[model samples]
Target: MNHLKKCLASLALSLGLAVSSAAAQEAQKIKMGVMQWETIAMTSSVTEHLLERHGFEVEEVEFQEWGVAFAALGKGDVDVLISHPDYAAADYWERNARKLEKLSVASYGYNAGLIVPSYVTINSIDELNEHKEKFRGRIIGVEPGSGMMRQSENVVNEYGLEYEIIEGSGPVAVAELKSALDRGEWIVSMYWTPSWVFQEFDIKFLKDPKGVQEPTETYVWLAHKGFAVQNPKAREVIASVFVPESALTQMTGWVKEGASIDEAVARWEKANANRLDRQAMIGNQ
Candidate 1:
């Protein structure tokens, strides 16, 4: 009877230790929200690698819509996300501002607006109307719910331009732009910088004289309201990362030329090995 009681006590202690160990592991795990955009993917990949190097596990949660992603972060379903709060995700950020926290600026000088090939004579949004007939009375745009498209709609209404904004996915819009450029036809489409298209084509953003669209934007690292308090170490590592506009554009161009996200990130990591090594050692001390 004494032996049996001792055996039972030992089993209970072991089970308690196992549960505690699992809980500790869970505490060190992070859930990252990822969008479909290439830049977001690249940033997420870089962040994941950095966090892993510092002993944190990262799991990416894919989101198809901006609103959904923001809501998930607010509810704590995701721990972090790379976002453009000032411009691209302004609406979503405003809606969920109370539930999210900005950790750091991931990149700077992200610009978005109407773009035209270099051969086009127009230089500004106001000039777009003058060449409406040449542009076929339409403005090519990306996904319907995207911030760029919403702002593009505002541009149309604000400018009072008589043209239809064609809604489509990013790839479709890019395909349309390429096709128009190949035919040497006049085409104006909503586009943003740090995009691969800039590398592939000689295009420029039309001047936004009325300022309906933000001329310069910043991409930021965002997290759930209490994420910083719960994961200070991870936050420090995240805050330590900052990719310049030129480097981001170069990596994006590489991805556009057939490199996978992993490959692009690997190349970027190799190029900045010394800086990354120091970044990884951020909270270790």
Candidate 2:
């Protein structure tokens, strides 16, 4: 009877320890917000792998618009968001600045504007108004609430374009552009850098004579308030991560062609192993 009591007590203690260990692991997990855009998706995927190497789990939550993403961060629903808030999402960041903090700029030379196939004769935003019928009187745009889409609307008004702006999700807009381009059909789609479309297709950004589109912006990672203090190592890794313009476009191009996020990140890691190792080394220091 005495031996059985000792055995039972030992088993209970072991189970309690196991549960506590599991809880600790769960608490170390970091939740990150990501948008549906290609660049953001690829960056988040790579960062997740890097964080895991640092013994931190990453939970990537996809948000549709900048507002929703910032809101989640502000409310502490997410720990961090990988984005270009300074340029593309300036409005949302301003509104939620008090609730969040900008950690580091992860990417540079980011750009977004109107683009057309190389086959299209149109060279500038100003010319679009004259050939609205050629583009079917429509400008394909992404995420209704995105700064890009808002600029697309302004382009229509400022240029006196008689075109309709068709707004959809990022992937949907990309698909529309692909389908149209595949058919050699005319399409003036709102597009940006680090997208596979620019690399995979013969496309060019239409000249913005009116300077409606911001040029060559930087992208940063934003964290919920006090996140840096709570996870200093993770914060260091986030700050150290950097993707050059050429590499970024290539990775996103793969993702644009149906490659899974993990697959794309894996490819990038293998190709840039030295660079990644350097980043990890810097973060550790």
Candidate 2 structure lDDT: 0.82
Compared with the true structure, the alpha-carbon lDDT of candidate 1 equals 0.87
Per-residue CA lDDT of model 2 for 98-128, tens digit only, reads: 9999888877878888889889998998998
Which window of 10 residues has the lowest lDDT sum in candidate 1? Answer: 19-28
* Candidate 2 residue runs with Cα over 4 Å from true position: 1-29, 130-147, 166-187
Q: For each candidate, give its TM-score against the true structure.
A: 0.83, 0.76
Clashes of 2: 1
TM-score of 2: 0.76
lDDT of 1 by residue, 1-285 (tens): 999999999999999888676545445789999987777788788888999998888999998888899999999999999888877788899999999999998878788889999999889999877878999999999888777888899999999999999999878989999999999999989888888788889899998889999769888999989788667778888998887777778889888889988898899989999989988889889
Instruction: Return the top candidate by lDDT.
Output: 1
